[model samples]
Target: MSLTEIRSRIAKACDAAGRDPGEVTLIAVSKMQPDHRVRAVLEEGQRVFGENRVQEAAGKWPGFREDFGAVELHIIGPLQTNKARQAMELAQAIHSLDRPKLATTLARLADEIGTCPDLFIQVNTGEEPQKAGILPSEVDSFVAEVRGLGLPLKGLMCIPPVDETPSLHFALLAKFADRNGLAGLSMGMSGDFEEAIALGATHVRVGSAIFGTRP
Candidate 1:
């Protein structure tokens, strides 16, 4: 699907949910995609993009920003504590703030730099052992800890177990976000974004549906 088509779907989803389409930020996930494919989307005026790694995003976006004038880069993958500074420098938002060690690292870096990117606490809604996120039980305390550090916490994020229905996870994230009065619920992806929008997803990470299959 083209960028326009994906956007249309987002708009439709918002309309069906009685939301203004403008409230949904569509993040074109360009991770592992070829440069040409990314540029094509850029040419279509897509300024917000998500990348999975700091190094790859650092390599790719500097040049794109030079050519495109301005772009919003979101680091959407699990971040190593050491990479926090680099990711902060490269992206406007970090969607995988999942652990305390990393949180402490970010808070220290934020204090030193005097600025931090928008952060979304990643919650392992499914509580999968292999996933990188705060377990369901830990979210409240984690939120307080992150807030106490004075980080720019924008909202919550989650990756539902693939075998389960996505809405259940979206709804679960919504519950947490609502409890915190978080303004950004960064859930949903290419396959289930509409359902996400319905369940109050402020940001949807759509990749293959907009950029085609990755190499």
Candidate 2:
């Protein structure tokens, strides 16, 4: 689909959800994608992008960073403790602040380096063992703990169980965010973004749908 069509779809979803499309931010996920494609999208007025791996993003970013000055880059995948420093340097937002050790490391790195990416607490809405986020029941305490450290703590993020309808998970997360008074909901992907928007997803990550099938 064209960029216009993609933007329209986001707008339609936001409207159907009784939301202003201006309130939702689309982060074009560019994992496994080439820099040229990202540049094209940047030209099309996309100002935010998401990448799953720091290394992959690092490889492509140097060439594009200067040109896409206002664009924001978010790290939306599992992050390792060892890579905390580099992750902080590269992303404007880090959406998977999963564990205390990693969070502490990030805090220290940010302090030492004088730059910290906006942080989001990732919730394993599905409670899947394979996932990286904190469980739903632990979010309040986790948020409290992270907040005490002065991290930006922008909001919550989640990946629903692959088998279930996404809205159920999205609703739970939306309510959770509302209860905590957080501003952003980094939920949804190419398949169920409309449902996420219906439940108040302020940030949606779209990869294949916008960039075409990954190689």
Candidate 3:
């Protein structure tokens, strides 16, 4: 799908949800996509993007940013503690902060560098065994801990189980954010973004629908 088509869909979703389209930020998931395809999206005026790996992003984005200076890159995958500094330097936001060690590293680095990108606490809302987010019950304490460390806690993020109803998880995340005084909810993908918008998603990460299936 083209960028225009995706934006049109987002507009329609917002309209159906009685929302202001401007309220939802669309992040093009650019992981695994070639630089040319990324440049194509850049040409289409997309400034915000989500990358899943620090290494892949490190390899691809510097030159792209040199040419497209205003791009916003978000780290949207499981972040290793050792890579926190590199992620801080490369990304404008990170969507996978799910543990204390990573949070501590980020907070320490941010204090040292005087720069911290927006942080989202990933919630394992589905309680999936292999997922890389904190359990739902752990959110409050973790949020408080990260806050005490002075990390930028912008909101929460989650990937609902593929087989279950996504709205349930999205609603859960929204409720958690509301109870915790968080305003950003990064949930939803290409398939269920409309539902997510209806439930108050501040950001939606769309990949295959825009760039086609990854190899």
Candidate 4:
């Protein structure tokens, strides 16, 4: 879909959910996308985006930021302990805060840097063993540990198993956030975002739909 068409659909989804369009955030996932395309989307007034690999983001982000100073970039992939400090330094938010060790590292780095961007607890709502996230049963203990680290906890994020209906996974994440007193749900992507909104997802990450197929 065209960028304009994407925004229109987002507005309609928010309306259908009885939510303020402003309350729901659209994160243009830019992994594997070139710097020029990122800048073009930013010029189109897209202010928030997400990147997957830390190395990929580190390599390409400078050019985009040089042009759009106010854009918020999120680190949305599995973060390594060695890269925690760099991620903290570069991203406006980190969406894959999935484990206690990573949280501890990020908390320490945030303290040293005097800045902690928004944090999301990634739950393996799908229980996919290969994925990077806390298991569903462990989210509460994980959040407790993160809270002790003094990092700001804003929400939950998850990518459900590819074979299942995403709404079930999105709803599970919403319930998880509610029980934990967290206020955000960064669920859904290109194929299932409207279902996500209906299920209370506050942040939906869209990539191919907005940026076209990535190289």
Candidate 5:
């Protein structure tokens, strides 16, 4: 329910997994959180945060950065092609690089700006049609395609179906990243991050637990 508690839990999870706590970056999901709550977390020494929208991040983080000095932002939501440039400017890493058009857009912008954010390919491991991610069957080819464009592909990401076992999808995502020689695994959330760390998650996005429930 608190940052320190979540961090302690992360340590326990890592200890259980034989991993250094430093290996897993905890992203405080700040989407829709009131500024006071966000500032409280920042005051408590949480610099890494996740946002689901570029426009909101643009409006919120600039002021926070001015006050906090250093903040690592991850765009962990669906990215429209038009918003790619703004997202790149705001986030240090993006966990939703799920489509080729977005990749191409990012590649073009990277060429123009000479820099790009680290990227995680979202894979729909559960094969949910409504989800925005590459199919499990299509991930290999998509990785190849994104790499071919010279975009900085860090690893893979996934959000398993709510009713399905999360670890199963996390493990599958790990396999895809391993075969491609990618290192980042942006899986896990407030509930199953320990299992994700056990299966090799490099980053776990935690919301409500850290910020409390949104109104």
Candidate 6:
């Protein structure tokens, strides 16, 4: 889909939800995409992007930022504890904060560096054994722990089981964020973002729909 089409869809979704489209932030997922394609989006006036790997983003974005000047990068994949400092340096927001060790690492890094990116706790809402995220039942205590650490806790993120209904997980994530007094819901992707918007997703990470399939 073209950027125009994608923005139109976002607007429609916001309208359906009785919201202003400006309230939803669109994060174009740029992980695994080549520099040329990223530049194309940048030329089209997209300033916010999502990247899955710290190393990949570190390699590509420094140059992009030098050229583009005003882009925002978000870390949208699982983050390793050892990379906390690097991620804080590169990303404006992080959506995959799933473990206490990583939280502790970020806390220490924040104290040392005096910078902490916006953070979203990833919840394995489907309770899948292989996925990263605190389970739904663990959210309250985990949120408390992360908050006490003084990290900038923004909201919650989740990837629902592919076989199940996504709206179920989206609603659950919204509930978790609301219960925790978090204002951001970094749920939804290309496949189910309209539903996510209706359910109150403050941010949506979209990939192939805008940039086409990754090569």
Q: What are the lDDT scores of the predictions, listed in order?
A: 0.95, 0.88, 0.94, 0.89, 0.95, 0.95
TM-score for predicted model 1 compared with the true structure: 0.99
Could you give candidate 5's per-residue lDDT for residues 137-174 as a string of tens digits? 99999999999999899999999999999999999999
As a whole number from 0 to 100, the lDDT of residue 128 in candidate 4 is: 89
Model 1 regions more than 4 Å off = none
Winner by lDDT: 5
In candidate 4, what are the lDDT values of residues 122-171, reduced to their tens digit? 99998987998999999989989998889999999999899998999998
- TM-scores, all models, native as reference: 0.99, 0.96, 0.98, 0.97, 0.99, 0.99
TM-score quality measure for candidate 5: 0.99
Colliding residue pairs in candidate 2: none
* Model 6 clash tally, residue pairs: 0
Cand. 2 TM to true fold: 0.96
Model 3 lDDT per residue over 3-94, tens place: 89999999999999999999999999999998788899998899999999999999988999899887899999999998889999999999
Off by over 4 Å in 4: none
For candidate 2, the 10 contiguous residues with the lowest summed lDDT are 62-71
* lDDT for 180 (candidate 4): 90
Residue pairs with backbone overlap in model 5:
none
What tens digits encode model 6's per-residue C-alpha lDDT throughout 108-212? Answer: 999999989999999999999999999989999999999999899999999999999999999999999899899999999999999999999999999999999
Q: lDDT by residue for model 1 over 1-215, one digit each (tens)?
A: 89999999999999999999999999999999999999999999999999999999999999999999989999999999989999988889999999899999999998888889999999999999999999999999999999998889999999899999999999999999999879999999999999999999999999999988998
How many backbone collisions does model 4 have? Answer: 0
Off by over 4 Å in 2: none
Looking at candidate 5, what is the lDDT of residue 142? 95
Error of 4 at 194 (Å): 0.5
What value does the lDDT take at residue 49 in candidate 2?
Answer: 89
lDDT of 5 at 133: 97
